[model samples]
Target: MLKHFNAKSLFGMSFLVIFVLLSSGCDIIPGRHMRDQAKFEPLEASSLFGNERASQNLPENTVPRGEWYDIESNEALYTGMQDGEAVENIPIAVDRDVILRGQERFNIYCSPCHGRVGDGQGMIVQRGMKQPNSFHSEQVRSQPDGYYFNVMTNGFGVMYSYASRVNPEDRWAIVAYIRALQFSQNAPLDVLTEEDLEQIESVVE
Candidate 1:
């Protein structure tokens, strides 16, 4: 004995309930479309950017945009070439600190192949790999400082370039350390007198 029931009201309530249930499951609406899209495309290229090409009609010898030459003279534009003239003719001094830093860096980066003594007898060489010439050799000793720097920067023979790995100052420091190694190996025994031996003994103590 219900008081009353309206047929139209009951029908409207059922429709509202169906609408709420369908809207609540919104994630299912795009399920088949997403799966189809993934099936069509399995991979995509990265959108990263790289260096731009030089502009057309530029002179062949002209430096590229955003780049600067170490020497302004056209004669010194090539690799390993430096202008003969220096604004100040002072020779850069090689200090102990710089040599120590160079030695540290060389041990980390070069010891694997060049050895701690620069004798081309590193671990790799012990394993039967090709050994580089000793830095103490006459040919290497006669080479100019710039020559070593250039070789390290651009590489020679089987060696790859280290321009990206080491900076200019560090390269110069390594050159100094190499000189030190050569000097120690070739030092005259006569130069070490009794006083020098006593000094060494005291330092050891």
Candidate 2:
């Protein structure tokens, strides 16, 4: 049997065996054999995409689950825009409860840079961070409610977008709260309640 097998015949048989094994998907190299397997973690970058983002945008015209109302029907509510401009009013109704919710969300998110009263004197600013414009400033106070909502959703200047962290409804709530803050610092005498007047008089006294 040894004499019957020449060197070329043995080499040919070995090559044939390797070819069959490869065709049948044998993992000769163990862990390194699966070169085409794709594994992507959240927020990881990938060269497979032109944007190098592992997370791809949803298909056009397809709304994700539980987002149809905002994405499909109420674009203004979600994006804070109408007719190519920021809407002059918040699309959602403003109420005490909504304002309170806004206050809570704003304290957690915006207060770091905008301050508790939106004076742009937050602790970060005192610690040498760039100070944003005060909400009480005439320029800011004159901006429409949707303008603030747009800034919160899309960001402006050095501020980053909160669209991912703050939901649309809560963003509107924060906008309402910002208005309340502005009014508190610049309220007219006629709009003050008796109790408010008394408090001011006591403070002045």
Candidate 3:
């Protein structure tokens, strides 16, 4: 049988439980070592290191995985510029497979803001987010492939840099994919070969 407690008795029991929880705070929970760690903040003093510093440089030639060891080796590839200008060409070879890879990467990273077809009409844009410029625009099509790489690396107005999410090689692949989109949408009919025209004519028919 469930017995109902008097109001005074229940009030005392609730106050006791609240007191216990308040006193323990979060320490009563288990497996919070990372959050409860004793790590020091930046510039904090730590006698654990030889220099008694919180931060120390990695040993010589200690190349961290998924990081550029030396930007000097290829400044164009890393910084997306040559002589402080966007290069007219990609540093790496732009093969069919590479462009396909770029297409995949672009869909993952750029499509959220730029759309699948580079029209800047992605889902987020429909949801009241500021729309970006279409890649098919004359201004964008005239820009060099390195310009796209530079934008992805450094970010343009209202867009954040994807450098942390996308590596340099994939950034070029995305540029190639963007160029492919521009050509597919804005290529002149005069430039189409006889065979290419026939394929399009048959599809339309």
Candidate 1: stretches off by over 4 Å: 1-80, 83-91, 189-194, 197-205
Best by lDDT: 2
The segments of candidate 2 whose C-alpha lies over 4 angstroms from its true place after superposition are 1-29, 32-63, 66-72
For each candidate in the order shown, give its overall lDDT on alpha carbons.
0.70, 0.90, 0.89
Residue-level lDDT of model 1, residues 60-90, one tens digit each, is 7976653344544432222334664311211
Ranking by TM-score: 3, 2, 1
Q: How close is candidate 1 to the true structure, as a TM-score?
A: 0.55
Model 2 TM-score is 0.68
lDDT-superior candidate, 2 or 3: 2
Each prediction's number of clashing residue pairs: 0, 0, 0
TM-score of each: 0.55, 0.68, 0.74
lDDT of 3 by residue, 105-200 (tens): 999998987899999999889897899989998888899878999999989998999999999999999998998999899889999999999999
lDDT of 3 at 108: 93
Q: In TM-score terms, which candidate is top?
A: 3
Candidate with more favorable, higher TM-score: 1 or 2: 2
In model 2, residue pairs whose N, Cα or C atoms come closer than 3 Å (at least 3 residues apart or on different chains), thus clashing, are none
- Model 1 residue 108 CA deviation (Å) reads 1.2
